[model samples]
Target: MLDLHHIFAMQKKALFFLLALCALGWGFTSYPTVFAGIAIGACFGTYNFWILVRRMDKFDRSISEGRKVASLGSALRFGSGIAAVAIAITLPEYFHLISAVIGLMVPYVFLFIGVFVSSVRNKGN
Candidate 1:
């Protein structure tokens, strides 16, 4: 069985790689506004993920102990992205809304990469 912790570690590395990718974005896109938008999204995604993990941990523990705790991570994650997009759209002259929207998907990008690599690697068995 694939180690879950190992997978999460890979995910973390991928998120950091996304951050590094921002430098490439800034250098290649020649639009600091877009890059800034992406950077903001990527940073927020990282924080959102961290918050999600913690919230899940707490919720899981509560469940194991036969209790229920409301999980707000999902709302927070969506809320932050929507808020960022709103900010970007409202300040068209400052940030590229499209890029910001794309940037918010950084986590999913890493998620697909992890799943693809894991499936391909395990297929050799």
Candidate 2:
């Protein structure tokens, strides 16, 4: 069984990799569209991260109360990369460059935020 820390680390690494891929893709693609994709992806990624954190907090509370906690489904749902990719594919041609950059950066930003939040919470305890 995976511990919380292990799970967190795994998630963080996945996010980082996703971000790097997005950045690399952006660099290889044209401008504008890539930037737009990145911007949109970042917004979505941040939103997903926050939602996952809240859900995890709730799950922890449930566990403390002896209730059966949900599996990692929520996390998977929140990290739905398919949605991000779909959005990226739909970006306007003129904004493709920006979108690509954002796509790459968003994942890394998500991981950073998650790690920062986790560290802060651990320190508080």
Candidate 3:
């Protein structure tokens, strides 16, 4: 099994990179709205990432205990993501929806990449 610490480290790197990218763009554009959007998006992205990590941890625990795991986490994740996007889209005047959306995907992208790397490393053993 892959270490959760390594996974989190990768995710953290992605978060910082994404935040820096947003900050740079905001700085270059001198747009308060862009900064606000990035802030909101980063919050939601981090929230989603933690939720996923928690769910996976719970699943692992359940498996080790020989119990069936529930699927409520998936629904909650989807609902939260949808809500974030909806709010971003509705508040067009305050946030750049595209930037916010991109920010929101940062954690997932990094997590996926981390998983891929881990899988490849294990396969080589």
Candidate 4:
């Protein structure tokens, strides 16, 4: 029931949230530590991104095109989960304990957003 525009909008919001987090880290954390966190985060993000991409590709191949099994919202949720874990791993060493806690929550936020959007669309249909 979800469309491309809905997916894109969610992605845009997520990216903006990420950028805001980065800015907050830069503003509060020391430069060297923030840089290290960024490096670690990027590495983790890249690794997980590839893994999720492969999984999604497999899902796409297995599912019928007419069926909405692995939609873009699902993809975003997966990506956000990966991102949250990455941030949790990367930021704890450099940022405050609270930031790390917030990082851990990112995946759930994305998951809820995805489910809410999907449910709304499905109900509308």
Q: Which is the leading candidate under TM-score?
A: 1
lDDT of 4 by residue, 2-119 (tens): 5434554564467556757677767786664554344344434433434555556667765856665654345664565566555656656664334444444443455468878789
Q: How far is candidate 3 from the true structure (C-alpha RMSD, Å)?
A: 3.0
lDDT of 1 at 125: 78
**Model 1, span 10-115: residue lDDT tens:** 7678767776887787778768788878877776766676667677778878889998787758988888888888888888876788888877777667667778
Model 1 earns a TM-score of 0.78
- TM per candidate comes to 0.78, 0.51, 0.72, 0.42
**To one decimal, what is the Cα RMSD in angstroms of model 4 from the true structure?**
7.3
lDDT of 1: 0.75
| Clash totals for all candidate models | 0, 25, 0, 0
What's the C-alpha lDDT at position 27 in model 2? Answer: 72
Which consecutive 10 residues in model 1 have the weakest lDDT in total?
Answer: 1-10
Where in model 1 is the C-alpha error above 4 Å? 1-8, 27-29
Locate the minimum summed-lDDT window of 10 residues in model 4. Answer: 39-48
User: Cα deviation in Å at residue 82, candidate 3?
Assistant: 2.2
Question: Candidate 2 at residue 74, lDDT?
Answer: 63
Taking every candidate in turn, the Cα RMSD to the unseen true structure, in Å, is 2.5, 8.6, 3.0, 7.3
Residue pairs in clash, model 3: none
Off by over 4 Å in 4: 3-9, 21-50, 59-93
